[model samples]
Target chain A: AQSVAQPEDQVNVAEGNPLTVKCTYSVSGNPYLFWYVQYPNRGLQFLLKYITGDNLVKGSYGFEAEFNKSQTSFHLKKPSALVSDSALYFCAVRDRTNQAGTALIFGKGTTLSVSS
Target chain B: GAGVSQSPSNKVTEKGKDVELRCDPISGHTALYWYRQRLGQGLEFLIYFQGNSAPDKSGLPSDRFSAERTGESVSTLTIQRTQQEDSAVYLCASSLLLAGGRDTQYFGPGTRLTVL
Candidate 1:
């Protein structure tokens, strides 16, 4: 079975500071990892994904994630935090072997709070 | 529509009542998915449909939950005798076919379902 873990329940960072939201996963085969963000009353928005490529992947809204195979982690990062960036972050994974219709297993989510 | 769209943006119903939520996937999208988000939690995959293949209902929580897709465009999720636990935001997403494991999903605003 595929699963994802987000160790932090909440992450607080000052404006302009670097922000990081950690995520780890377990899968039977090569994993397709994804990062999504959700604001209140809205559905999730895709941030980035790591299919197969360089360890570093850039995504929308100036966000990026690093896929560390050895650590089984895909951590979301932003060079500078903004108050508007505060939202709930989720990490998801699906077995690469599964077809496009396979469902993604999501982490418990980490609330990101960026304060000015 | 420019993006995936869900109907009945806000629904409040008494317990044991049945409710139905609808989703309109992006035009030409061959894959659609349904997910549930409880308050303060991440997404939970509910069902997936791809092209003309049978829909995957493995992620559905119970038999009371059912969904149907018309070809590849619109989908409807129905919950019978809904319980308080069923209260959550139901999200819909769509993506292109998965040939290289790089399909990006676009999400809808989601329908907030409240069971009293």
Candidate 2:
């Protein structure tokens, strides 16, 4: 079974500083990875995805992630943080071998706090 | 007309009561999914529906949880005899296609379920 792990439960960064949220995955085959953000009482919003091409994938709200096959990691990053960017972020992975019907497995999530 | 929409933005029900959550996927989307999000937690895949075929109900937690979709448009997730553990936000998402490589899911605002 494919699984994802987010090492940190919360990450705090000042407004204008760079931020990083770590994510790792274990899957049998090539992995399709995704990042999502959820605001208070809102649904999960898609951020970015890495399928089979470039290792670096850019997403909405100035967010981006690097997919490292060797490390089995896909960490979300931003050059600078904004207070509006604070939210609950999730890392998800699905095995490419499962064709089109397999479900995505998500990490426990990491809460990002951007303080001024 | 816009994105995925869920009905009854907030639902408060007593323990042992039955609750129904509705999801209306974006028109022309061929795949629909249901997920649960507890406070401070990531998304848990609850079920997946593709077109009019039988849904992938494997992610359901127990027999008390069930879901139905008509044709390929709207979906309803039904929880029988709800418990405190069932107090979480139920999210619905839709994708234009089912192929795993390039499918991106758009989510609804979610229905917050609180069991008292």
Top candidate by DockQ:
1
Off by more than 4 A, model 1: none
Candidate 2, residue A18: CA error in Å?
1.1
Query: DockQ, per-model, please?
Result: 0.73, 0.69
Best by lDDT: 1
- Ten consecutive residues with minimal summed lDDT in candidate 1 chain B? B96-105
Q: Please give the TM-score that candidate 1 achieves against the real structure.
A: 0.97
lDDT by residue (tens digit), candidate 1, A1-116:
78899999999999999999999999988999999999888888999999997999999999999999999999999999999999999999988987655778899999999988
Clash number for each model: 0, 0
Q: Please provide, for model 2 over B4-113, each residue's C-alpha lDDT reduced to its tens digit, 9 standing for 90 to 100.
A: 99999999999999999999999999889999988777789999999877899988999999999998899999999999999999999998875654688889999999
lDDT digits (tens) for residues B1-116 of candidate 1: 58999999999999999999999999999999999999887789899998788888988999999999999889999999999999999999999876855687889999999999
Q: What TM-score would each prediction reach against the true structure? A: 0.97, 0.96
